[model samples]
Each structure stands twice: as structure tokens, then as C-alpha cells.
Target chain A: MSIPDTTLASAKALVAPVLDDTSRAQIRAERMSAFVRYTLLITVGFLMLYPLLWLVGASFKTNSEIFGSIGFIPQEPTLDGYRKGWETSTPYTFGRFFWNTFLIILPKTIFTAISCALVAYGFARFEFPYKKLLFASLIATLLLPNVVTRIPQYILFRDLGWLDTYLPLWVPSAFAGDAFFVFMLVQFLRAIPRDMEEAARVDGANSLQTLIYIVVPMLMPALISVALFQFMWTMNDFLGPLIYLSSVQSFPVSLALKLSIDTTEAFDWNRILAMSVLALLPALIVFFMAQRYFIEGISTGGVKG
Target chain B: MARLQIRNLEKTYTNTFKAVHGINLDVADGEFMVLVGPSGCAKSTTLRMIAGLESISGGEVVIGDRVVNRLQPGERGIAMVFQNYALYPHMKVRKNLSFGLRLQRAPKAEIERKTAEVARILEIEPLLDRLPKELSGGQAQRVALGRALIKQPEVFLFDEPLSNLDAKLRASMRVRITDLHKRLKDQGMSSTVIYVTHDQTEAMTMGDRICVMKDGHIMQVADPKTLYDRPANAFVAGFIGSPEMNLIAGRLDGNSFHLGAQSLVLPDELMARLRANSGSVTLGIRPQHLRVNTADGLRAVVAGAEFMGHEVVLHLDVEGERVVAVLPAADYADLDRGTTVTLTPDPGQAHVFDQSGGNISLSTSQ
Candidate 1:
């Protein structure tokens, strides 16, 4: 394409009608502020991500290079740390540990979702005796510190011969021991109009059927959020598994990662960082994948009317 | 098909707060009875009691020959279309229509057949695959009606089902529901419908008999024409008509009603009833019954005039009382604000209520 037969002066005039000095100055000022704002934001963003960058860089560096400077670029990158992290100084590999974590997380997440949903449905829909009292107690439990009952629960589990087993980690979820999930699900259930359940009841469905068919399907996003929350929290749990699972063979990734750091001698910092990165991957992937439902579930469930 | 009887139906909350006082109503088989009132009148509560959704505190709900007060909502053989149209948001229209029958363990073919029949009847067959959220308000309402229809229940309950629609859609849907009632009767589906609404227009149009309620008390139960013509009290008179009846407090002296500086000669029958009560009365005159002219009547100042298409409503200040008169637009279109006019109430159409608002002039012969 060729330009139209117009003088450069006319082209300039066409591109911009003349502006008053104050208006031109205002435009310049707006551009300057926008440029400054973007630059500041980008610098702050980099500052916040510096630690994660250092971790990723250090995972591929030798221990000497890692401690050489605060800079994130590795002098020499190698797969040795990943190789060593995959096969730790234990009888079982990280693969087995990942499997162990999954064993605990999958069932715990499922149990939490199912049990909490049923409990929430009961609280939301039914007019049972002491319903308000029970719901109030459930919310009150949300404010109770976990450390308050930790010792008592540990002692009870030990007395039941459930020590060194995943039972201690996942069993409580089957009974909706997580008050937060139950509370969240209850709010979600309440946001659902009573009309749907009433319609179901009029359609000849019993209470259980109404829960399964009407309430549960409408509650899918919230239930998925509950499952995702349980999965991530269970995966990242350190204190619980450390308290119960003493045997190295039964350890989850969170505990196994702790086991690899040798404080008595020179620690394999690179290998530890590599394994840490690997451990975070699953949670990061899960969060990114399900964040839409997580956000929607929270906003929708939190609306009272 | 069954006759429904509510014998002294009462609903008390926490054994103290009486939401619905004891009220008796008999809805014959195939009758469309509308329980209409202002908000907090317990009209919805009354319908729920009949549907077995709300447990009656002190009454018997009998359907056919069986007392159904102890029965569950589903077991009472009633289907309800809720105010919000309560279509399962996640389900397609077909599934919504078929769900009730499916829950009854009906055969798949029968459920399909009935759902198809209802869809055809409602002209929602093309919308069968669409979810509730995808449909318009009117379509969602049709699906709600279809869901209730497919159940083939003995009784139908509508809790202000058209209240959520736009005014135009509401007017059209009102005719649709009335036509549905007629169609059901013609089809030998003698299902009794007990609809609850706060809109007097819906009560006047859709109901075979309108039960007017106030503060949990039954005010009157009559057909639309009777309700409009012979309201039982000032409350019913003011509630039943558009723009409401002009109820002005006055004293009856012989055959004349003395309302401030304005005087009206009371009808002979009403004068007798007023004589018997012998106290201040609320003289009820509907807007259409009041005529505005420059000739012989109570002199008044027209404060404002609103042109409402075919008719004009003039806001008149008569003896310091704000009275409204509906006049034909073609005849009174040029009447300006601040104009002086004489207002005359048609004696035949006037009503006289005693100080307590009871219609003393509703003759016993009627």
C-alpha cells in the first residue's frame, strides 16, 4: 500500500487536532504517571518473586555455588540434585513417598468432602432437635485452637494402637473433624434456595434423596473447593505426620523432605531444594487448575440471601 | 381429583406467635380458590398448610375423605409451583418435568410420555433440552407449571408463581394460568388449585372465588364480581379495586352523610343500616363511581389529573379530603389542575361502613 498524496504538514494536522497547552500538559503528565506506576509495579513484583527464583536456581547449583552469592543464576546447572533427591538416603524412593502422600490425601480429601457435605446438608435443610445449638457449636469449634486438642487426640490414637499408621491422619476426616469445611459447605448449602429442596420433597423424594439429587448437584463447586482445600492441606501437613508416622517407610513427602536435611553434617541443600520444588508442584498445579471453582464457591457460598 | 377442606386452620410459631389464626375454608373439587391479601396476611401460610408443607397448629386439612394434616407434603398428593419458579437450575426442562414422576418409581416410558404431553401442552417442547437459567422468566414459569402438571396430583398450590415476571409477562401469564384451569376442567382433571398472591388483580382475574385475608384473619370469600361489587368491609373495599375505594369518615344524620363541609344523601337502604349503627361511618366510593362536573354536586378543587390512556384519574380535594375520581378521557381530557368541579357519588354504588369498618350497608338479602 502507498500513502495518499498529502503533505507531511497536513498528515500531522490530520493525526492530531491542536490541543490547548494545559490539555497537552495533562496528557503528558498522565503518560508519565502511568509509566512510573508500571515500572514500580514490575520492580515490586520481581522483589516478591526473588526468593522463589533463588530456590529454583539453587536447586540446579552445587552447594558451593549456592552459598557463593545471593544471585539466582547458577554458575553451573546439573541434574545431580534431582537424581539424588529422587532416590534419597532411605530404603524407599521419593516415588514411594509421593504414593504415600497420595494414599493419605486422596482418601482424606474424599472423606472430608463427603462427611462435611452430609453434615452441612443436615444443618442447612433439616429442622432437627437442637439444630441451632449444634450449628452454633460447629461454628464455635472453628475458633478453637488445634493445639488445644492435639495432645488428647494423640493420646487417644496411641491408646487405640493406631500409632505409626495413616489411620491417624485420615480417619478423623470421615467424621467431619474439619469444622472449616463443614462450615463452608453449610454456607454454600444455605445459599441454595429452599425452593429446590421443597420442590424435591413435593416430588416424593425423601430427605436423603433430596440431599443426593438436588442439594448435592447444586453444591458441586463448593464440594470441589472443599476437596481441593483438603488435598492441599493434607499434602502440606508436617506436624501431624511427624507426630504419628515414625517409620521412614510410611512417611509422606512433607516428612520425607524434612528427613533429607542433615544438620549434623553438610546438608544437601540443592537436593533438598529440588525435592521441595517437586513437592510444591502438585499443590501449585491443583490450585491453578481449580482456582476458578474455588473463587466462585467462596463468593457464591458467602452470599447470605 | 379431590375436595380440600381446611377446618379451623391455624399456624402458631414457637407455640406463641400466631402467624395464621384459625380460619375455615372449603375448596371444592376442581375449584380455583385464591387466597389473596397484603404481605404478612398469612395467605402463603394458609396455602402451605393445605399443601402439608406447614404443619397446622390447630386444624384439620382434609383432602377427599382423608384428613391429611399428618401427611407429608408429597403424601398429601399436592404439587406446588413456588414464587421463584424453583426450576432445578442445573436440570433441563424435560428432567424438571419428569423428576416428580421418576421419584414415584414410574416406568421410564410413562414418565417420558407424561413429560412430553405436558411439554406439548405448555408449548415448551422446543425448550426441553435447555436449562432453567437459559430460559426467560416466562419460560421458566411455564416449566414450573409443567413440572406441577406432569405430577397429576390431586391438588395444585401456587405461591405467587407469577410475581417474579415483568408486568407484561405477568398479565399474559395470568391469562395462561386461567386458561390452564379451564383446560384442566375440560380434560376431566378435577384438581383443586389453592393459589396465594398479594396482587389483587391476580386474585380478581384467576380465582373462581377469592378469599380476602388481613392480619391472619379471613375478611371475605367471594367470586371476583361479588368481591368488587359487595366487599364485606372497608378493608376489602379498599383492597379489591384498582386505585382503591375512597373511604371518607362521616356521620349519618337522617338520610344524609355529613363529611366535613360536603353533604351526600345516603341511599335509603344504607341510611337504614347507618341509622341502626348510629355512629361515625366510613363512606366507601369507588373511583369510577364518582362523577366530576360543574353542575349540582359537592364543590371540589381538582388538584391534579393523570391521563391513563382510555381514562383520566383526577385527584380532587373535596372538603379537605383527598378523593380520586376516574373519568372518561375523551370527555374530561381538558380538565386542568386547580379547576373547581362538583363531585357526585352514585348512590347505588356507594357503601357505608360502621366505625369499626364492618360494611353495615351490605344488605342481608344479597
Candidate 2:
């Protein structure tokens, strides 16, 4: 958003002094800009990861140590809570919960990315009847909250007797195509000059061929971003599985971890804290694995993340 | 080799934007046709429609012997070079060149052979292993060309391909492209080509015949010399030249045209073109054709001078209108700004246009 390199280029061009004239101001300007960029980068870098660092440290800390300290890293670290969270008999059933979450997330991430990218290609590169209408409808759904349609979706799934299956969790997502992701991808696809697609087309590619051979290959960044979002959301989802899935085996990790709230004894503070840390792992892993795709100004989406 | 026949081609977007109006053109088996126009003039749009990239709202695009309007672009057997050289960022130059071949399931050795051949032709053999981002603008441009060239399609469409290169490189590339055409012709490959560029110089130098376009319509189509010498209309005359043709308002009063307080004898051929119009007519003349004479024609006051190394362009104010005279650097040695000189108009080189900007050929009626 700051457009530093571009701004610098334009500024250097537009603000050049007369050839015979020299000023200290140019050097000062260079030094000032470099200083500002470094300071801003370091500040934003710390701001982005400091909280996550604290959470990781807290996850490794004992309950007493966590409560007593505000320092980032655990002074005395232990993996006992992680060990407790990984056990099935601990009431939280953390391992099974993680597996359940992953079951939805793994498929959801892949299918959502494919569907969204496919639909986005259709929207971006093709012209057909009702194209404007279809695009408008897709964009309109972006603003429509899940809650507004959740009740109806629940009833429909129940009537089909799919309420207990992962179908209701991951199936709608496949068709829903993550409108935001689709929209993001569509925008990225639009930025690509039609010439590449034309070159593909003239070389004997049909629409699908162009999409696969040219368009999809070009949209790697956007697709990865869409995949990352779907992975995180599916892993951390609380509401859909909560309402539709009733069976303990079908419950995702987010819902299963909520079982840490005690119905019989005093509130299990250690387990709650431990389960939260374990829950953060999937998203952290996802972000780390997909960080390479989040590079900016690479002819795809000019997004940093 | 293929003939490209476009008959009554039209493209209208759903948003009610009509990019290309009805257009008709036919190319011989290996004719090099260049489409020249300003931006948004529908030249590229017309090319895309022919390539089947943009769906035709109305018209027929016949390639070789097949009506390919509804056919997919790939089946049309054409390759295109784009302005920005839209190379695959993830792929090396070799892979970029061979992408289409691979997609069509060509044998690996054949792909390698074609890639190597194209790389060698473009002198990019060493850079084939490098990514597009690592290449300079000229290198990237050659890669795009090599990618298109390796396909060996029946038709080649260049969409402002040299617009991205620096001045020196673009000039050199044009010569190389012309050389490539000759080499291809010698190889007995007679592919039809349609190149699109807004640069008139490129069109003039590269085209066998140029189709001058304006506002989605082909204004004129002619060989480069004819386009320069006998422009079909005022628009074509002005559009085809650099430092553009200077058109001035004048009156056709008898056998000679009157400009301000000066009169030049019109050629017998052009004199017959003057109609009995109620108002003033416009006179069209190229700067290079106007010679500085001391004895005849309109009195011009030199206003400015642009010394272009080889040629010095002497800007003149004649009858409250600006006209430029491009003379060899030595010719203007004795002249300075504000030097009053009479210019001799060469009637044979003059183009007469009516108020509507249409060419009115003089038939020597007088």
C-alpha cells in the first residue's frame, strides 16, 4: 500500500534538481526514507508476531508460570499440558479432535481452492449469457452472512439426513466456492492480459485448456491465498459443525475442544489453556507452509499475505 | 500457409460496448498485413476476435479453408506476441517456448529441438534456463517472440510487441523481425501474419500493406509508400506521418488556393478536385515536401528550430497557422528563428481534402 519503490522512482524522476546544481537535500531525503522504511518494517514485524509468540510461550508454560508472568518466552518450560491435550481420556480428547478438524480442513482446503479458482476463471476469462448477472450474484453472496442462511441449510441437510456427516461441513463449502476467494482470484485473473489466454487459445486450446494451461498456472498466488484461508477457517470453525453434527465422532476439533468446559467439576483451567494452544497449531502450520505464496507484486495478486 | 479471410466481422460486448464494427479483409497465403491505429481504435480487438479470444457478435473468420468463427482459438492455428511479453513467471525461457507444444502432447525431443531452434534464432540459447524475471526487457521480448515463433502457426499476430522495448532495441528488433520474415519465407513457410501497432513507423517499415483504422473502422488499406504518398483521406494522411501532416484552412479561389494573404498555384490534377463549396476548404501537405523558396508561394516566418542531428525541423508561422519544414541539417545553416522565407509547395506531393476530410482526386478538368 505504501508503494515505496514506485514512489521513490517517481519522486527521483520528478524532483531532480538542475544539472549544475547540487544539494545536500537529496542525500538527506534518501537517508530519511531508508530510516523510515526500516523503522516501519521492524515495528510492523513485531506487531504481527508478538502475540503469537506469547501464545506459543504460554502453551509451553506451566499453569502457575503462565499466571505469574507476562514475559514473552516461558522462563521454565514444560510439555506436560501438550501431553495432557494429546490424550483422549483427558475429557478434551484432543488428538481425535485434531484429526476430526483435519478431516474437514484437508479436503475443504483443496476443494475450495480448486472450485474457487475454476469459478473465478470462468468469471474472469469467459463471456456468456447472464455473465453480469452471475458475477453480480457471486459478489452479492459475499456480503450475505452464513447465519442468515444457516437455519435453512440446516433444515435442508437434516431433510437429506446429512446432518451427522462431514458432507454438511465440507460439501457446501465446495459449491459455495468461498466467494471472497473467488472474487480475489477473479480480480487476479482479470489483471492478467487477455493476450496470454489468446496465445493459448490460438495455439489450439479450448476454454478449459486455456484455464488449465494458462490461467490457472498464472493464478498460483491467489489460489494459495484462497487455500490458506479455507484451511484456517475450516480448522477453526465453531458454528457449522456445532449445529449440524451431533455425533461425538463427527465433531471437529473446535467443537470437541469446547468440551473442556466442565459439566460436573470445577472449571479445568489447565486443559482449557492447553486445548487453546493445540488449536492454534493447524493455523500456524498453515500460515508457515503457505508463506512463500504470500509474496507481493509477482504479477498475480499484489497482496503481501 | 493459410489465407485469413474476415468478412463482416463485428464484436459487441454485453455492456453495449461495440469494440469492432463490421470489418472485411482478405489476405493472400503469406501476406504480411499490419493493423495500424491509435489506442481504442479496435485493431487489437479485431485481432482478438479473429483469434477467437473474443467472441464475435457478428461475422465470419475464415482461416485457410475453414470458417473458424465458432471454433476454439487453438484450432484456429495462430500464435500471438503481446505487448508486455506475458511469459510464465514460474517457467524458464525454454519451458515458456515449449508450453504450447507440451500442451498439445508433442514428443519431448521435438519440444527440445523446437525450443533450441527458437532460442538459437533469437540468440537466447544461453538464457533458456533463466526465468523471465531475470531477463531484461529486450530479452523478455525475444522470449515472447521465440515462444510464438516455435509454434510455427499458420498466422502470427503481433500486438504492439515492440512498444515495451527501448528505442534502440525496438529499431533493432524491427530489422530482426523483418529478417525473420525473409528467413521464414525462404524456408517455404508462407504463414499469413497480421501485426497490430500504434506506431506508424513500425507499420510503414514492417507491413506489406497497412490497414489504417479509426473509431473501429478501417479508414484505408494500402502499401506503405502509397499510404505515405497518396493517403485516402485527411485522417490517413495525418495518421501515417510523424510530426504529423500540417493541415491548414484555405480557400479554393480559382486555379490556385489562397492561404491567408498568399496564393500557390495548385497542380492541374488537384485544381479539378476543388468543388463549389459554400465555405473554406482545407489544404493538406507533408512537412518534408514543402521546400523553402525565396520567390513563390506562402510567406512563412520561422518560429522555432529543432535540430534533430541529421535533420533540422524549422517551425514556421504562415497565415496564423503553424507549418514545419524538415530540412537536411546543412540546408538550415543560414536560417534562424524569425527568418522570413517563402515556401514552395510541390503540387504532386500535395493531398487535397474537402471539409469532410475525404480525398478528392483531381481529374485535370481544367
Best by DockQ: 1
lDDT against the true structure, each candidate: 0.88, 0.81
Best by lDDT: 1
TM-score per candidate: 0.92, 0.83
lDDT of 1 at B364: 71
Question: Model 1, B71-130: lDDT tens per residue?
Answer: 888898899999988888778999999988888889989988898899999999999999
Docking level of model 2 = acceptable
**Full-model lDDT, candidate 2:** 0.81
Which stretches of candidate 2 lie above 4 Å from their native place? Answer: A1-85, A90-93, A263-268, A295-300, A303-305, B15-19, B267-280, B361-366
lDDT of 2 by residue, B190-241 (tens): 6578999999999999999999999899999999988888787889989988
Computed on C-alpha atoms, the DockQ of candidate 2 is: 0.34
* lDDT by residue (tens digit), candidate 2, A1-305: 57789889887877776532446767778899999999999999998988777777777888777778788688877887677656644454666777788888888877887788788888887677999999999899889987898888889989999978898877866885578888888888777777666666666667787777777767877777777777877777788888988877767778766765633265444456677877887798878877888544234453211
